[model samples]
Target: MKAVMVSAFGGPEVLAVVDLPDPHPAAGQVSITTEAIGVGGLDSLIRSGALANHGAAPGRILGSEVAGTVTEVGEGVDTAWAGRRVWALTGESGGYTEQAVVSAETLVPLPADLSAVDAVTLGSSAMVAHFALRHAHFARGESVLVRGAAGGIGVIAVQLAARAGAGAVAVTTSSAERGARLRKLGATHVLDRAGRGAQDAPAGYDVILDIVAGADLPSFFARLEPNGRMVAVGVMAGTPPADFGMEMVAAFRKSMSFATFSADTVPALEQRAATAELFTAASRGELVAVVHEELPLEQAVVAHQKMEAGEVFGRIVLTPSRR
Candidate 1:
């Protein structure tokens, strides 16, 4: 099978297409033939060594999720899964290849109505958005604010917030074009993120989903309404500094709380439950995933570059150049 491997750690230039022996499934696993592989920002982070401290160094393919048809099922697995279309999380072995092995448990059977492209696009993103909002204890009629709302998880956050009956759904994005797209997706207000958050955002948000973390933390903290809650999600901009401090006097008096959500922190069954809900929603056409571009697997370097350049507002799908 051909795979796009991060031959070295540095930049998108390091991603190389290499032919490797096809991977086979072990017990309780299945082999999936590539259809649409999700090209996420975290894959770029691993290729660029930005997450080297967390073991994202080179010499590995860096796909996060895959949507494909099951070609083979290993022992202890149900043969019925074979030939069934599915989408699953691939973890670190990655899914940027013609064939990859995935744990059977991670596979989510795609409804006949859902295309593999759309399933892969929102597979992990919708679940993350759901988990983040749930962690914040989001309530109906609450005002919701989503940072990095043009990106994968953030876009889902915006949609889910609006669909969940948020009194208002505000989003922050890079341009008028992206913001307008977000508005069509359910954002009641779209603010330009290039400006200071405090200056760009409306005050009194009941739920703030912070996908971009940087020097903008304090400003975002200020936008929270009294008793508002903020959930720190993806650190796409950069991780918060150790000394990151907010003006807590107001926060303390208002009973506002800040927290973080990670899929790793949740139980496996709980995570899958969220994923199931997402798949059900997608099948019902209640959740829509945007695919910004599709490229051959060998063009991973181009994909990662586009991600880092902020040229893509949605997920990118990559397929093996060969069968």
Candidate 2:
């Protein structure tokens, strides 16, 4: 099997496609022949040495989400899943290759209307969005603010909230053009990051799905309703500031809850079920993965470059160029 492997941490240049042994499933596991690979910010972090100590890199396969067909089954696995289309979030890294193994429990069947490309594109982002929104216990007629609303997770979050009966969904993006596009994707309010208008998001939101961190925190925390909740999914803008104490205290006093989500930790059953719901929504034209581009797996370096440069407006998926 050919895969993107990283032996050292540095940059996108570190990811090299090379032949590697195919992974065989252990007991209770299944082997999937990769069809589409999801490229994300975490992949970049792992390649750049940021996640080196996190136990995911160095002489390891580099991918977290995959959509593929079952080619083989291990002991204790149900034979029914063989040849079925599925996607999964692997706890350990190995989604970039031609074939990868995962516990049968992690597999989620792809819907008839959804393609392998779409499944991989949404990957864990949609799952995380669902968990965050559901965990926040949002009610009908409430409003929420979302940062990075044009990105993979934000787009899904906006649609989910809208369908769940939000009074309004306010979203912000660094690119004015992308912000404009988000409006058509169900965003009720689109703020331009170029003009510092994100500062006003606190005024109208009862909850916030934060994908970016740093100075944006102060502005975002101030926008939440008295009992509003904030789910922190990423720190695209960098880490929090030194004086982040105010927001922490505000959250404590107002009974606000701050949380983070990782699909890697999601239960296999829940991942499959949530992914099925998301795919159903996509099939009905309710939720769609805003795919900005598709590149060959060998060009993963270029994909990471685009993501890190903030040039991509939505999810980018990689496909194996060879069988």
Candidate 3:
């Protein structure tokens, strides 16, 4: 099997394709012949040593989610899954290879109408968006502001919020072109990456889904309406200052709230169920899987480069079978 590994944690250049022995499934596990792999900002963070303290290290296979067909099942596993197509969360790694092994329990049977590319693109990201909105206690007709709304999670978040009947779905994106695309996905308003157009909201946002957390974090916090909730899901711009939360404390009179969310914290059963729902919605065209482009698996380095450069509009899927 050919796998891309972090030769050394530094830049995209550090990712190298190397030949490795095929991996097999253990008891209660299954092996997949990967068709598509989802590349995410977290993968870049792990590869660049930005998350070193979080257990990232050299020689790691850096991928989290993939979609493919199951070719083998381990002991005590159902034989029916052997030839089934599924989307899987590979935990924290092992997805950047032609074949991946994961616990059978983590598999979400792909909808018959969903392609591998769409499966991987919407799998984890859609679930994250779904849970984040729920965590924010989002209510129908409540205004939503999706910061950094051009990535996989952000794009899906916009649609989900709109579909749930948000009065307004505002997004912070890099350009008019990207924002225009987001509008088509249900964004009622578009703001620049700096959140320039947020001031137009009459009472500020009722819920803010922030994917970029950094120096600008405080500014967005100020845009929250009284009693509003802000959920930070990704630190793509980098982590905010340690005391960034002091803003929330100082604004205590407004009764606003701030929180951080990760899909990891969601129970496995719930995550699988949510993923299934998302896949079904997408299959029925109730949702859209925004794929910026698909590259061969060996181009993992290029995928990381594009993501870090902020040149991608949506998910960049890697087709392992392309090679």
Candidate 4:
């Protein structure tokens, strides 16, 4: 087997692709011959030492999501899973490899027609967006805002919000071209992320799906409509200001609510259910999983470079060499 390892915590240059022994599942787990691997921002964070608290050490196998065919099952697991097409969270290892062993609870059977590439790409991003929106308790005819709407989760959030019957769908992005593209994907307004574009939001928004965090977080919080909810699922803009706690005080009179979501701690059954729904939606052509590029697994270092530079508009997937 071959896997990409983080030789050290620094930059994409630290990524090393090397041979490793094939992995087998343990009790309550399954082994997958991976077909598609998801390259995410978190991978870049881990490589750059930005997420040191995540406990990643040198020589770590780096990937969190994968799509593949189940080739084996472990103790107390159903053999029926073998030969099935499935997608899973590799937890902390094996995702960047030719094979991955994941907990049975993390595996979700794919629709017969969904390719492994699409399944992993859409399933991972949509899982987070779905959970965040569900927690916000979004309602029909309300104005919805998706901050950082060009990335994977942000793109999916825009489409899901529109489908949920939002009267207006607004998003913040880095460029006009990206904004134009997002508008075609159901965003009614695309604000220039680095400017005061958000100040133009009319009467504020009802449900805010925030993928960014920084000194500006408080201003984003202040934009919520009365009784509005803002769900923070990412910190792509870096950590929020030290005074973020103080910023929340400004939202008190508006009755605005704030919450944060960490997919890391989401229960297995819940992750399964959310991913299943995304798979169904994708199979029905109701949800779009925007893929920016597909590269061979060997190019993972380049993939991480693009992600960290914000050069990709959607998900980038890595494919293991065909067996």
TM values, all candidates? 0.94, 0.93, 0.97, 0.96
Per residue, candidate 1 scores C-alpha lDDT tens digits across 1-323 of 88888888887888888888988898988999988899877787778787899867688777879988999999999999999988888877888988988888888888888888888889888888999999999999999999889988988898899999999898888888898899889988878784333344456799999988887876777778988998998788887765564465545887888898887787767777788788888889898888899888888888888998899987998976554
Predictions in order: lDDT: 0.84, 0.80, 0.91, 0.87
Which residue segments of model 1 deviate by more than 4 Å?
194-201, 246-250
Model 4, residue 100: distance off in Å is: 0.8
Candidate with the larger TM-score of 3 and 4: 3
Model 4, backbone clash pairs (residues 3+ apart or across chains), number = 0
Model 3, total clashes: 0
Best by TM-score: 3
Better of 2 and 4 by TM-score: 4
RMSD of each: 2.0, 2.1, 1.3, 1.5
User: Which lDDT tens digits does candidate 4 get at residues 1-323?
Assistant: 98999999998989999988888889999999999999887788788888888787777899899999999999999999999999999977658989999999889999987888898788778999888888899888988889899998998999998998989999989998998989888998878774256555666888888898766778878888889999998888788888877768755888889999877668889889889988999989998888899999999989988887888987999999953
Under the 3 Å rule for N, CA and C atoms, how many clashes does model 1 have? Answer: 0
Residue pairs in clash, model 4: none
Model 1 C-alpha lDDT versus the unseen true structure: 0.84
Model 2, C-alpha of 254: deviation from truth (Å) = 3.8
Q: Evaluate model 4: give its lDDT.
A: 0.87
lDDT of residue 142 for candidate 3 = 96
lDDT of 3 at 274: 93
What stretches of model 3 exceed 4 Å from their correct place? 198-200
